[model samples]
Target: MLRRISFYVVIILFFLGGCSDEHGTSPTSFEYEALPAPGNFEITSGSYSLTLSWDYSPENIALAKEFFVYVVDPYQYGGNIYPVDTLTVAEYNTSKGCTFDKLAANMEFCFVVSAVDLSGIEGRRAEAECGTTSAP
Candidate 1:
């Protein structure tokens, strides 16, 4: 009976060792580098809107598959980052500016632009820029 129990324990140990992963991580896990944040951010106030501009270049992008604009409503307490617009690679390649319209006059807004890769991962956010809309 003692010999039989030892043999069973050995068999269990062998199966467990075979099931162990060499990397000790999921096989689907992948590592990707994030893109650099946008630079030279500038803002202009307009009637009920704010215009945002930044320096952009094709060389500035690294592994970025797309771009997006994020906005923050300062008046709303605990304001979360919200996506206001989606930018395509082509649009981002050509235009350096975007506008946030239909906003409350005299209110200030903060903006950030981020790049997303093909894997649906967002990169680092640009420095936040705040601007106030024209008063009525």
Candidate 2:
């Protein structure tokens, strides 16, 4: 019986040791990780508005509601950060898409999206870039 108890204790310790915050550090706090690889993203078009997309990441997400998308320019836009938009959809389409109706015509906008994991952790953003597509 003593031997069995020792074995059980060691097993429990191992299990606990493998768990920690997403940063691979001590679990003092918990936060979501950025979208996989190409974190938040953006796309634009002269004819229409900009579109953005991202990936879900952090290995483990618990309760994310939405992602914030930002569009802007270096000189013309306010603070290089324009209209901030929230992406709200079923878990199936939140971090993997963008919007066009959210922009204006003839405007040069940069795109970037960040993954707000289910756990409310704001992950890193994908690199930003500028572009414009033909409007409808």
Candidate 3:
């Protein structure tokens, strides 16, 4: 009878242990860090605007909560980068492009996209992509 009780106690303890967070790590034990940069950045021209496209970082898509799009207008400060938009994976169109409209026609613009994680961390941005909006 004692041996049976011991076996049941061991089984109960084992089940409780497995119920805890992964591998004995507490739920709050994990640390959040900035995600990696995006990849395959591309830009296209539109009438009085530009379109931006990029691939999620090789391993970052799973961790990324959203994406930030930045624009640098040469006409703004001879070139000054500014936050222009935010996008989610679901918003991508058939062409995989996010179009920024109402831009100054015939001007050059630069774009970069960064992944933002759940912890509100902004990751490194993809390489800058430059293009000129079609003349209006």
Candidate 4:
């Protein structure tokens, strides 16, 4: 029984050792370098809607694969934010913005946009922009 238990332990140790890379780090471990945040974030208000826009430099544009848009209700959530939409580079270039419609009129919403690379890693978020929807 002692020998059997020792053999099982050795097998488990071997399997665990195999799970690491040559660098002695686990295979699941990764090093990430975050991209720069989007710039010139602006918001435009419309009746029951709001549009969020941002800018990126030529180098950043080349690095970014998509943009993640987040929204928050300052009054309700006390500044808690969540992602609402994602825009591909092509889609954003075409419209120059993303619109969220069917919102409560005359209500304020805050937004932040972040650039994501092809590997689906998101970078820092831009400064928040807030706007109130036009009265219906």
lDDT tens digits, residue span 1-136, model 4: 9999999999999999999766764678677888898888999999999988888887877888999998875767457778899999999889877999999999888998999987888999887889999976
lDDT of each: 0.80, 0.59, 0.78, 0.88
The lowest-lDDT stretch of 10 consecutive residues in candidate 1 is 55-64
**lDDT comparison, 2 vs 4, better candidate:** 4
Measured with C-alpha atoms, the lDDT of residue 45 in candidate 2 is 51
Indicate which candidate wins on lDDT.
Answer: 4
* Best candidate according to TM-score: 4
Tens-place lDDT per residue, model 2, 57-82, is 43423345566677656676444665
Number of clashes found in candidate 2:
13
Cand. 1 Cα-lDDT: 0.80
What are the models' TM-scores?
0.67, 0.51, 0.63, 0.72
lDDT of 3 by residue, 1-136 (tens): 9999999999999999889865664567656577877777888898997878777643666676778888776677556778978887556423455888898888888887888887788888777789988975
Q: In candidate 3, where is summed lDDT lowest over 10 consecutive residues?
A: 88-97
Worst 10 residues of 4 by lDDT: 21-30
